[model samples]
Target: MRLSAYFMPTLKENPAEAQIVSHRLMLRSGMIRQQAAGIYAWLPLGYRVLRKIEQIVREEQDAAGAQEILMPTVQPAELWQRSGRYDDYGKEMLRFKDRHEREMLFGPTAEEMVTDICREIRSYRDLPKILYNIQWKFRDEVRPRFGVMRGREFLMKDAYSFDLDKDGARRSYEAMFRAYMRTYARLGMTAIPVKADTGPIGGDMSHEFHILAETGESAIFFDQELEEKSRAGELTVDSMNQYYAAAEEKHDADKCPVPAERLRTMRGIEVGHIFYFGTKYSEPMGAVVQGPNGETIAAEMGSYGIGVSRLVGAIIEASHDERGIIWPEAVAPFKLGLINLKSGDAACDSACEDIYRTLSEQGVEVLYDDRNERAGVKFADMDLIGLPWQLVIGPKGLAAGVVELKNRKSGEKQEVSLEAALARLTA
Candidate 1:
């Protein structure tokens, strides 16, 4: 993508309304714009990152043996009524009436709706089925703030697993647990799964995956060893559950098992959650399957959720520096930023064009800045957007038969021959 043709309307100053680093950087980088309180319209650059994150979530879900399916944003209120939660869900649910005066709602979550779907399975052979969807969800937050991190309208990946018994339900939960860990790791995040309350979903077992950040909303306490294991890529579902990890509200210091020396406390932004509610919704909604003995039994179920849109902000909160967002390679909108320092200079233009063509031909996503702008402006814009690698070309450098390669995260630069630069970038 060429910046000359791209719709990145970057701002020079921070917006007063943005209280967090992620929100401010997102606005300055021209990734998103607020349409209303707690709602935003993702601009082109932001949309590309959003899609990349969504695709990674999709791929991990599929690899975990969960089949993908599209579910409606608007759900019939009867499903909630049948599950005995219609009146209890409270104001967060956007409930209303349709043209025929029938009750409906923009689903805040899909537990009841998924349970209704599972009601079709009559035999145990259909047990252990997991289905997921990546879609928009709406919640009427009384005070929606912190940009997309707590937006009223956001994208989410929700998966529901139905099994014949409690044991089967636990196995399904474990599968999702592993999948969630892998998903976060791929996004360049170290997510710690801590024991959590089941909230309105009403589950016997629950875990919330949180990414550690200084500006995070929730305070968490956990075993210090977890961090070492996470860094070593050795975290397992069993280890996560067995270790001492809890949210602030749930952590009882007196009863904590970890010694003070091994305890680590930090603030974390919640990005994913999983629940094993067993028959909570299935029993109430009549989602039953026949057992081997021919007896009717309610399907045990679990629901897993990852905040697809909120992750964009969470990642920024965890990864950005003073300049701007430092996007992870897997979720970066583009892998390389090609800055033509002297646009229209015959030699400079030719060099940049050749480099851009070579990289693009090799299946690299490069954003070439071919605009007639000052070098400082080009550098500032590129840093604000935060591509992993940047290639700087100028008349002086071109004349010397070399181009400057920069690593955004480390702020390191090296001058290498054009051929060498291409080899390093492509490698």
Candidate 2:
């Protein structure tokens, strides 16, 4: 994408209402624009990042043997009523009446709707199946603040599993558990798995994935060794859950087995959650399958959710510096930022154009800054957007037969011949 033609409306000053680092940086970087309290319109740049995150979530879900299927955003209230949560879900659910005065609601969660779908499976052969979707969800927060972190409208990835019995359900849960760990690892974040209470969903097992950050909302107490292992990519669901990890709110000091010296405490942001809510929705909604002997039984079930839109803010909360967001390579909107330092100069322009073309042709996503902007302005904008690698081409560098390459994360620069730069970037 060419920055000159792109619709990135970066702000020189932070928006007045943004309280958190992610919210402020997102606004200043031209990623999202707030339309109302806790509601936002994802501009093009923001949308690109959102899609990238969603795709990663999708891939991991699929790898765990979950199939993709988009459920409706607006579902019949009757399903919730059958699950006995229509009224118990509280005002956070956007309840309403349709044209003919029938009850309807914008789904805050899809347990009820997914259970109704499982009603189609009539035999034990369909015992194990997982369905998932990445879609927009809404919940009317009483105090929706912190930009997309607590937004009224947001995108989410929710997946549900149906199994023959408790044992089968446990296996399904484990698959998702490992997948979640792999997902966070690929996103360039160390997400610790913390034990959690299954609130309205009513489950015997649950875990919330939290990314540690200084400005995070929840306080966490965990095994210091596990924290290090998670950062070093040495953790699997089985090994991670063996260690003690919990939010401070749910933690008991006396019950903790880890020695005080081995415990590490920090603030964290919740980005994903998984629950095994056996028979909660299925039993109530009559999602039954027939046994070989012809007995009907409610399928054991579980639900997993990842905050797709919230991760946009959560990522910034976890990864950023004074200048702006420092996107992890996996979720970065573009891989490289190619700057034509002197746009109109023939040598510089040709070199940048050739490099940009070569990178693009090599399946790399590059954002070329070919605008007639000052050096400082171009550098600032490039740093603000936070692409992983930046290739700077200027008249001086081209005259010397080299281009300047900078690693955004380390702030390290090197001048190399055009071929060398291209080879390094592609390699």
> Which candidate has the top score in lDDT?
1
lDDT per residue for candidate 1 within 317-367, as digits (tens), equals: 999888898999999999999999989899889888888899999999999
**The CA-based lDDT of model 1 is what?**
0.92
Estimate the Cα RMSD of every predicted model relative to the unseen true structure: 1.2, 1.3
State the lDDT of candidate 2 residue by residue for 16-55, as single tens digits: 9989999999999899998888889999889899999999
**TM-scores vs. true structure, each candidate:** 0.98, 0.97
RMSD in Å for candidate 2, one decimal? 1.3
Candidate 2, after superposition: displacement of residue 304 in Å?
A: 0.3
lDDT for every model? 0.92, 0.90
By TM-score, how accurate is candidate 2? 0.97
